[model samples]
Target: MDPNAQPDRLSDLPDVLLVLIMSFLSFKERAQTNFLSKRWESLYLETRDLSFKESDFLTASVYANPIRWLKARADFVGYVRRLVDRIRDQPIETFGISISYPKPYLELIESLMAFAVQKRVKSLVLDFSNLVWRTYNDVNIEKLVVKIPQSVYDLTSLESLEVCACKDFDPSKLSKLGKLRSVSFGWMELTDLPPLLETSRLESLTMKECLVHDLEKISSVHLREVAIYNCDFYFMCIFNLPRVDIFKYRGDIMSFGFDQMNTIISEVELDFGAAEKKNDVSYDSYGIEAGMICEFLNNLLDEGRRTATTLTVCPFLLKVIPRSEHPHFLRPMKTKHLVLKTKLHPKEFNGIRLLLLTCPYLETLTIDLLPPSPIATASSYAGIDPQTYWMQNMSYWCLWEALTTVIVKNFVGGATELNIVKCMLRSVGERLERVELHMPFDLDESRKTFALAKSEMLQRSSMNVKVVVHNS
Candidate 1:
C-alpha cells in the first residue's frame, strides 16, 4: 500500500520549518536537495548558514596532477562567487570559508566577507591553513598574509570571529561590535591587544602560536576564560579581570604579572614547557633558575590560594623548582583540588609528598603519570630506596584528613608507584573514602599490578576504602 503513496508528509511541512531542517545539511547536500521539488528548492535558497570549503571543489586526483588542481581551484572560486552573490541579500546567521591562499582568491574572499557583514552574519570563521606547503628541500613556502578587512571589524551583529594563519592582526582596527563575545586568533602577529580587551564585550579569548610584542596588560571585566598557547611576547600582564574563572597558559611568558584577579576561580592550568629560555627571569642571567621558579611558584600559589579551587602544574614546571625549596614554596593552601603531571619515580615521590603536606585541605588529588624519561629513571633512584626515602620523610608528613579521593592515572604499579600508594594510604588514614587507579590498557601486566594493589589496600583493614582499578 505504501509503494504507491508519495512521501508528501515531509514536503507538506511549512517553508520555515523545512528551511530549518535544511540548515543542518552540508552545502553539497543542500544544493542536491534543490532537485527534490520547487518548494524544497526555494527553502534551500533561504538556508541561513553558508559554508564554502576547498574540499567541495577538488578530489584526491588534484594532488597528483597540478593542471587538474589549477582548474579545480578556478572552478571553486567561480562557484564561491556565485554562492556569495545568491546569499548577498539573504539574512545569514553564520558564515565559514576555508580555502588555500592564492593571490587571485583574496579579493573574492573579501567580497564574501563583506556580503556576510552586510547580511548581518553573527559568526565568521576564516581558515587558510591549506595554503601552507613544504618543499622537497624541507623549506616552508611563504604563506599568504591577509589583513582582515574593515567589514569584519564593523559587523555589529557578529558575536564570534575566528581567524587562522593571518598576519598584521591589529585589534585597534576593530569597531565597537557590541555583541562580540568570543574571539580566537591563531598563527597571527599582534602588536597591542589592549584595545581589543578594553573595547569588546568578550567572554572568552584564545591566542595560539601567535607572535606578540610588548603586550602590556589585559584588563577585561566581562572575560570568563583566557587561553594563551605557544605565543611569543616580550612582556605581558593580566591587570584586571573580575569575572575570569578559567585561565590557561602554555607558552613562554617573558614577564608575567597578575595585578588583579577574581576572588573565586574554578581552574588554573600552567604549562611551562620549553619556555624557560624566553622567560624574563632567565637562568643564564640570574644563575639561580630554581630560586626564580620558586619565586614564581610562590606568587602563583599566593594568588591561587585566594581563588582557585583546582590547580594543575605541568612536569616541566616542577623540574625548575629546587628540591630544597619544595616544602617552603608549597606551603599550606585552601585549594581543594591538586593535579601533578609527572613521572611517578623515586625522585618525584618527594615532590608528591611535599605537595600533600603543603595542601592540608586538599580534598581531591590527581597524579597523571607520564612515561619515565631515560634521564629521570636513570637518576631517579640514585642508590636510594624509595621505601627508605619515604621513611626518612615520614616526620614531615602531615595528616591529610580532608583528602577523600585519590586518582592515579597511567599507573604501572612499579615499586616506586606501590611505595607512593602505601605512603598515601598511611597518611590519608581511615578517612580516605576512595582511591582510583587508571592503568594503561596496552600493558598486560597492569591487571596483575591492579590485583596486588587491591590486596595491599585490603590488608590495611582500617576503613572501607573503595579501591577501584580500571584500564585507561
Candidate 2:
C-alpha cells in the first residue's frame, strides 16, 4: 500500500473495540457485518451480547398466514439453537429473547436458557406474550405457559432477570442465584416474594399486571426501588425495607402495612383508581380502609420521618381518605415536588387543599387535569365549592415560600380547573418562578376562558413568574 493512501480506520480498530461496537447491534445485523471483510467474518462470533426476537425473522403478512407463521417459527428456533451451539462455550454478558408466537416452544426456549446458564450470562430477558393460541373452531393448537427451568437458578453470575407472561412463577427457585440484583416480572402469578428478599441481593424489583396471592410480607434490607403497577394482591405487609428510596404502587391495594420503612424515601407515588369497586367481593365488603391507609401515609410522610420528598397522588385516593381521619391528613410532609393526577372536580380540590396546607416546603407542583367521571359529576358532593369552603377557613391558606414551578397538563380551563390554577398561583406568591399550562388541542368555548385564566394567573404570580401556555 502507498504511504499516501488513506488508511481504513474502522478495519484497523482494535479487536475489543470492534466487538464492543458489534454488541450494540442486533444479532442479525451483527452477522450481516461478516461479509464486510475477511477480518470481520469471524469478528461477530466474539460479540458478547445476543438479542433475538421472533418478529425480526417474520414479516407482518407472514405472521397472519398460519403456514408461513409455522415455517418462520421453526426457522427462528433452528437459528437460535445453532447460535447458542456456537456460543455455548463462550461467556455471554447479556442475552434476550422475545417470542410473541402462541406456540409451545418450551424445548427450544429451555435449551437456550440452559446454554446461557452454562455460559454464565449476566443479564437475561425472556418475553413471551400471547403464548397460548386457538383456532377459529376453538381447537387448541397450543396451550403453553412458561415454567423457568431449574438450571437458571444455578446461574450465580446472573445480575439482572426480566420475565414477561410467565405463569406460576416462584421466587424460591431464585435462592441459588445469590448475585441477582435487579428482577422484573409481568403478567405472572406469584404466591409469595419473601423468599427473594431473604435469599438474593436484589436491589430493584418491578411487578406489572401480576397476580400475587398470600404476599404477606416483603422484608428486604438490600432493595432500593420497588414498582408495583396494576398488580392484584390479596394482602401485603412491608415489614422491613430499610434501603428503599423510590416506591410506586398503582391499582387496588385492599390492605397493606409498612412496619419498618423508616429510612429516607426520596419518592412515593400512589394511585388507587376506583380500588373499592374493583376489589374482590370479600375485600370490597369491608370497603376502603381509610384509617389504615391514612395512618400509613402519615407515618411515611411525617416531618420527623422526613422520608418522602416527592409525592404523586391520584384523585380516586381522596375518596378513600375518610373525613373522620382529618388529623392523619394534617400531618406536615417534607415533600418538595407534588404531582396530582385528577379531574378538577370541586370535591377533589379539597384534597389538593389539604396537601397544599401540609406540604409547606413544596417547590414544584404538577397537575394532570382530566375530565370528571360520570360518577363524580353526579355525586352529591359535586355541588360543594372549594373556594367558598376555603373562604371560611382563610387562616389555613398561607403563603408557600418555597414553591417555584407549576406544570398543569391537559388544561381544558374549565371553571373548576381555572379555580385550582388561581388558587396555586395566589398561594405560591412572589417565590413562584414559572407556570406551564399544556392545553388540549380540541378546545371548545373554554379557549377564551383559558386565555382569561392565563392572564389572571400571571397577575397573581410573582413579578418574575414566566407563564407558558401551549397546545398539547
- List the pairs of residues colliding in candidate 2: none
lDDT, candidate 1, 77-192, per-residue tens: 88777767665567889898887654567777777777777778889988765533321122122554666787787778889888876655677665388898998877666676
TM-score of every prediction relative to native = 0.72, 0.72
Q: Give stretches of model 1 more than 4 Å off.
A: 1-92, 99-104, 129-143, 236-238, 276-287, 301-305, 324-328, 345-347, 371-398, 411-419, 439-463, 469-472
Whole-model lDDT, model 1: 0.69
**RMSD (CA, angstroms), candidate 2:** 7.1
lDDT of each: 0.69, 0.71
Give every collision pair in model 1. 254-280
| Regions of model 2 farther than 4 Å from truth | 1-47, 53-91, 100-102, 131-144, 234-236, 274-292, 302-306, 319-330, 370-381, 384-396, 410-419, 437-463, 468-472
Best by lDDT: 2
